[model samples]
Target chain A: MPVIEVNQLHKRYRDQVAVHDVSFSVEEGEIFGVLGRNGAGKTTTVECIEGLRSPDGGSISVLGLHPARDRAELRRVLGIQLQASELPDKLRVAEAIELYASFYPSPADPRELLERWGLGAKRNTAFGNLSGGQKQRLSIALALVGNPRVAILDELTTGLDPQARRDAWESIEQIRRGGVTVVLVTHFMEEAERLCDRIAVIDAGRVVALDTPAGLVAGLIGGQRLRFRPSIPFEDAVLTQLAEVESVRRSGPHVEVTGGGDLLHAVTSALARHQVVPGDLRLEQATLDDAFVALTGPAAEN
Target chain B: MNETASATRTMARAPQRRAPRPFRALAVAETRLFLRDPVTVLLAIALPSVILAGLGAVPALREPADVFGGIRFVDYFAPSLLAINIAVLGLQNLPTGLATYREKGVLRRLSATPMNPSAVLVVQLVINLVTVAVGTVLMLAVAVYAFDVPAPRHPVGFVLTFLLGTSAVFAIGLVIAAVAPRARIAAGIGTVAFMLTQFFAGVYLPKYLLPEVVVRIGEFVPPGIGAFQGAWTGDGPAPLQLAAMAVIAVVATAVAARFFRWE
Candidate 1:
C-alpha cells in the first residue's frame, strides 16, 4: 500500500478554484515530486496532505489515517516544511530546534541533525541573522526533527544559490536514506529531475503528466539530434537516404541530423559507405527542462 | 539515474517513542523571547515604577488631601500605577506580541507540527503574567520603602481583585489580537484601547476629584474599579466590580477563541 494517497482532490478558496482535480499516490519510500508553475495549486495540494488545509472534494489518506479526521494522529507520523513559513526573528537556531523536537514523542538529536545539514556553527545564531541558504537549511532540519516516517517540503530550494541548492539536494537524499518518504513541491525542473523518483506535472490545477524523470523526458517528446562536421564534403542526400533520418541540414562544414530510434547507426553506415569520416560528432537529447516547457508552455514562465 | 546508488544507502526506520512534556519547553522559550523585547520590558515592567518615583518627588503629592479622605497624593496614586502596569501589559504588550508572531508565520509553522499553535498563545499569556507579577512586586517594594505608601490593608482582597482585573484586560487583548489583520493594526487598536482604559483608571487625573458622571463610568470598568480603586480602598471588595470583571473575562475570552486565526 502507498504511504500517502491523494485522490480526486478539489479545493476552492471562495471563487478562486485553487485546485480543480488532482490525484496521486506516493509509495512507501520514494521521493515524489509535485512540479508546477506558480499558482498551479502545488502548495495547496501539499497543504491538504499536511492537514493544513481541508479539501473541498476528495479523500486524502496519509499512513492509513484520514488527513482531517485523524490530523492529531497523522501529525505524529508526518513532518511538514511550509513555503514562506518562518520562526520568530529573535529565536535562536538551537531554541527553534529544541522547541520543535519537544512537540514530538521521539525526535532526532538536534545537534546531529544540524551538523549533518551544515548548521552546527549556527546553533546560537538568531533566525534573522542567518543568511537565506542557512535559513532554508534550518527549516529543513526542523521538519526532520520529529523523526517522522514521511515529510512534505514545499518549495524547499526556492531563492537558494546554486551551490546551496545542490547542498540541499544532498541533505534530502540523506533524509530518504534515513527511511523517510518525501513529497517535494517545486517548479525548478533541474531540482525535480535530480531528486524526484517520479514527478507529477501540474498545470492550471490539473495533472498533465506523471512519470519518472527519464520517462517524462522521453514520453513528452521522443527524439534525438546528431551534429557533426564531415571530414570531406559529400552529397547531403546520401545521409537523408537512410529511412531512419527524419531531417538533414548542412551549415557550412557542419551537418545536423534529426530523427528517432537507430538514426545514429543508419547515418554512420551511410557516412562510411560514402568514404566520409564524421568529425566532432555530438548527440543532443531532450531534458526535463524541455519536457516541462512542452507540458506547461506559457504557464510555466517563472 | 542514481537509483542503484540510493537503493544501497537506505537505512532502517526506527520506532521512536514520545518525549517528555513539551509545553514547558515552549513556555521557557517564550519567556526568553519576552525578556528580550525592550518595548515590553520598558513599558510594562520599568515605566510604572518610574512614574511612581516621579510622583513621589513632588512635594504637593506628598501632602495629605481631603479628596482622598486625608490620604497623601502619592499614597492615592500607588495602586493606580500598578493598575496601569497591568493595563499596559494586557491592552498593548500581549496583542502586539501575538499579532507580530502571527504575521511572521510563527503560528502557522507551529500548526503544521505535532504541537498545537494555540500553545504559543497560551505561553505568551503566561509569560506576560509573570512579567506583570514582577512589575507588581517592584511597585509594591518601591511604594513601601521609598515613598512610604502603606501596603494593601486587605491583602486577600487585593490579590483576588488583581487576578480578576488582569484576566479581564488580557481577554480583551486576545480579542484585539484575533481581529487585527496585521501587527501594526493590532498596535493601533491596542493603543486606542489602552488610552481609554487608562483614562478610566484616572492616569491623567485623581479618581476621587473626577466629576460624578466620570466616576460612575469608571466604576463599571475593570481597570478603574476592580484594579485601581479596589487596590486603593483596601476595603471590602465591591460585589458589582467583581461581577463586571467576571462578565468581561468570560465574554471576551469566548470571542477571542471563536475568531482567533493561526495564520
Candidate 2:
C-alpha cells in the first residue's frame, strides 16, 4: 500500500494560493521526488504531507492517518528534515543524537546510527563547526534516528558543494536500502534524477507531470533534441521539411530540431542535402533538465 | 508562482505522553550549553553578587544608619540585590536565549520532530530555573556569611517574595522573547527592561536619597524591591505587593503563551 496519499490538496495564505489541485502518492520504500523551481509549491506540498501545514481543501492520508487530524500519530511514523532548519549552534553531535532520540518511543541506537552515518568520530564536534556536507549528513541522520517508517527530506543539498551533494546522495540511498520510504523535495534536476525513483513535477502550484526520471525525459517532446551550427547557413525549413521533425527553432549561432522516431538520421540527411555540414556537431537526447524545461517552460521560471 | 510563505504556528496536536525523560534529556543538553559559555553564565548568575560584595566593601555602607531603621546600608541593599539577581536572568539571559532559538529556526525544527515544541521552551525554563536557584543560593551565602548581613528575619516570607518576583519578571522576559522578531532586538529590549528593574531595585541610588513619591512608585514596579525589603525587615510582606506580582505573573505568562512565534 502507498504510504502517503495526497489528493486534490489545496492551501492558501491570505489571498495567495500556495498549492492548488496538488495530488500524488508515495509508495513504501521509494525515494519519491517532488521537483519544481522556486515558489512552485513543492515545499508547501511536502509540508502538508508532513503534517506541518493543514490543507485548506482535499484529503491527505499518510500511513492511513489524516495529516491534520491525526498529527501526533503521523509524527511517530514520519520524520521530517525541513528546508533551512537548523540545530542549536553549540549542540554537539552526540548530544544532538541523545536529545532527538528521546522524542521517540523506540529510537535507533545512537552509537550505531552515528557510526553508520560517518559521524562516529565527530561525535564531540559542535554543529556550528561541522562542514556543510557533515551538517547535511547530520540532518539526514536526525531524520532517520526516530526509526520512522517514512522520512520527508526537503532541499537537503541546496547549499552543499558538488562533492558534498554527492555524499548526501549516498546517505539517502543507504536510507532507502534500509527499507524506509522517502519523499525527497528538490529543485535541482540532477539531484532528483540521481536519487528519486519517481518524480512529480510541480509548476505554479500544480503537478505538471509525474514519472520516473528516464520516463520524464523520454516522455518529453519527440524523445530527442538535436543541436548543431550548420557549416553553411540554410533555411530553417531544411530540417522542418522532414516527416519526423516536429519543431525547428534557432538558438543563436545554431539550429535546434526536436522530433520523434529517427529524428537524428532524418535531420542529418536533410542537412546533407542542403550542402551544409554541421559544425559543433552534437546529437542531443533528452535529459531531466530538458524535461523540466519542456514541462515547466522557460516562461514559468519568472 | 509566489510562495505563500509565512512562519508556521506550532499547533497543539494529539495527546502527548506525560514523560519526564525527554524533558530531562533536553534540560541536560541546555545545561551543557549554559555551562559551555562560562562568561555568559558567570556574568548572569554571579555579577549581581559580586556587585553586592563591592557595596559591602565600602565603609559607609557597612555602618548602621538612621534611614535604614538601624540596619546597615549594605544589609538593606543585599535583599534588593537578590531581586536584581532574578531580574538579570529574566531580563537579559532568558529572553536572548529563547529569541535566538526562534530566530535560528530551532523551535520550528523541533516542531517537526515527535517532540512537542513546548518542550523546548519548558526545558529552557527548567535550566534557567536551576541557574537562578544556584545564583540565589550563592548570593545569599555572600550576603549572610561574607558580608555579615544578618539573615532575613522572615526567611519564609523572603523566599515567597523571591519566587513571586521571579515569576513576574520572567514573565516579562518571556513577552520580550515572544514578540521580538530577532535575537538582537530581544537583547536590546531585554537590556532596557533590565535597566528599569535596576533603577526600581535602587541599585543606582539608595532609597533614602530618592524622592518620596519615587520610593512609593518603585514599590509597585516588577522585581519590586520594596516587597523584598519588607519581607527582609520582618515588618511587612505587603499583601498588595504580593498581589501585584501574582497578577503580573499570571497575565504576562498567558500573553506570552498566546503570542509566541516559532519562527
Candidate 3:
C-alpha cells in the first residue's frame, strides 16, 4: 500500500490555480522526488499532502487517513521541512532541537540526533550565527526528531554547496534505510537523479512525466548525438543516407551524427568501409537534464 | 527480515505521541527569546522607573501643588508613567515582535507541527503582560520609596482599572500586528499609536492643567483614563471611561482574531 496518495488534487489561491491536476503516490521507505520549475506547484502539491493546504477538488490519504480531517493524527507521523522556514534568531541550536523533540511523544534523543546530523559541536551556537548549510542541517534534524513515518522536505538543498548537498543526500539515504518514507520536492535535476527512487516532473501544475532516473533519460535516447573526426575526407550524405542517421553535419574536420538505433556501429562500420578511420570519437549519452528539458519544455532550471 | 518489518509496523501502529501540554513548548521557547531581547527588556522592564526617577529628581516637581490637591507634582506623575509602560510594550514591542515572526514564516512553520500556530501569539501576549506587570511594580516601588508618593486610596479600584487599561492597549496592539503587512510597517504603526496615546495620557503635560478639549479626549484614552481619574487621586476610572476601555478591548480582540494571518 502507498504510504501517501494524492489523486486528482486541485488547489487554487484567489482564482489563480496553483495546482491543476496533481496525482501521485509515495510508497513506504522510498525517496519519491517531485521535480519542477519554480512556481510549478511542487510545493503546493506536497503542502496539500502535509495537510497544510486543503485541495479544492480531490482526495488525499496518508496511511489511510484523510489529510484535512486527520490533521492531528497525521502530524504525529508526518514530518515537514518548509521552504525558508526559520526559528528565532537568538534561539540556541540545542534548545531548538530539544524544543521540537518535546513536541513528539516518543522523540529520538536530540543530543544523539544532533551528533548524527553533524551538528553536535554547534549545539550551543545561536541560529543567527550559523552558516547557511549548518542551518539547513539543523532544519533536517528537527524534521526527523519526531520519528515520523513519512518526511516531506521542500527545497531541501537550494542554497547548499556541492559538498553539503552530498552530505544531505547521505542523510536522506540514511533516513530511508531507517524505514521512513520521504517525499522530496526539488528543482535540481542532479539531486532528483541521485537521491530519488522515482521522479515526477511537474510543470505548470501538471505531472508532465513520472519515471525512474534512467527511464526518464530514456525519453531522449533517440536524439543522442555522436561526433567524430574522420582520417580521410567523406561527404555528409555518406552518413546521412544510412537508416540509423537522422541528419549529418560537418563543422570543420568533425562529422556530427544525430540519430538512434545502432548509429555508433553503423557510423563506425561505414567509416571502416570507406578506408577512413575516425579519431576523437565521442558518444554523448542522454542525461536527465536533457530528458527534463524534453519533458517540461524550455526555461527549466534549478 | 520479518522481525524488522514487524518492528517497523508496530512502531507505525502505536498510538500517536504528543507534547506534554498544548502550548507549553511554544511558550517556553518564546519566553527564552523574550529574555534575550535587550531592547524590549530595557523598555518594558526598566524604562518606566527611569522616567519616574527623572521626574522626581527635579526640585520643582517636589513642590506642593494645589492642582494636585496639596500633593507634590512627581507623586501624580507616577501612574501616568505606568501607563506609558503598557503602551511602550503593548503598542511598540509586542506588535513588532509578533509581526516579525509572522513575516519570517515562523508561525507558518509552527502550524506544520502538532501545536496550534496561535500558541505563539499566546506566548507573546503572556511575555508582554509579564513585562508590563514588572515595569508597573518597579515604577510603583520607586514612586513610594524615592519620591514619597502616597499609596492609592482606592487600591482595589486602581488594580481593576489598570488590568482593563492594559488589556485594551494590548488589544489595539494585536490589531495593528494582524493588519500590518510587514514587521517594519507594524513597528511604524505601533510607534505612531504609542506617541499619540502618550500625548493623550498627559505624558508631556499634567492632566489637571491640560486644555479642556485635551482633558476630555484623554478621559477616553488609556493610561489617560487612569490619569484623569487621578493616578494617586485613589478614585478609579469613571464609569464612562471604564465602559469605553472594555468596549475597545472586546472589539479590537475580535477584529484581531478575525484578520490575523500566519504568513
- Best model number under DockQ: 1
CAPRI quality of model 2: acceptable
Task: List the candidate 3 regions with Cα displacement exceeding 4 Å.
Answer: A221-223, A228-280, A300-302, B1-22, B227-231
Which one wins on TM-score? 1
How well does chain B match by TM-score in each candidate? Answer: 0.89, 0.89, 0.88
**Runs in model 1 lying further than 4 Å from the true structure:** A228-257, A261-263, A266-280, A299-302, B1-20
Candidate 1 per-residue lDDT over residues B1-263, each given as its tens digit: 58665534432222343454789888889888877788868778878799999989998999998877789988887776776788788988899989998998999999888889988888989888888888988988888889888877778877778788889989999999999999999999999998878777777676776788887787667654534555556575677787788789999999999999989
TM-score ranking, high to low: 1, 3, 2
lDDT (Cα, tens digit) per residue for candidate 2, span B1-263? 13222212111211242323777788778888989988978977897789988888889989998888887988887866776668778888899999999888889888888778888788777777778878988988888898887777788888788888889999999999999999999999999998888877777787777899888888877877888888877575788998898899999999999999888
Off by over 4 Å in 2: A226-257, A261-282, A299-302, B1-20
Decoy 1 TM-score against native: 0.90
lDDT per residue, candidate 1, A192-282, as tens digits?
9999999999988899999999888766533668999999989868977777777888888899998766777888999999899999999
DockQ of 2: 0.35
Q: Cα RMSD (Å) between model 1 and the true structure?
A: 4.5
In model 1, how large is the Cα lDDT of residue B27? 87
Interface Cα RMSD of candidate 3: 3.4
How much lDDT does each candidate structure score? 0.85, 0.85, 0.85
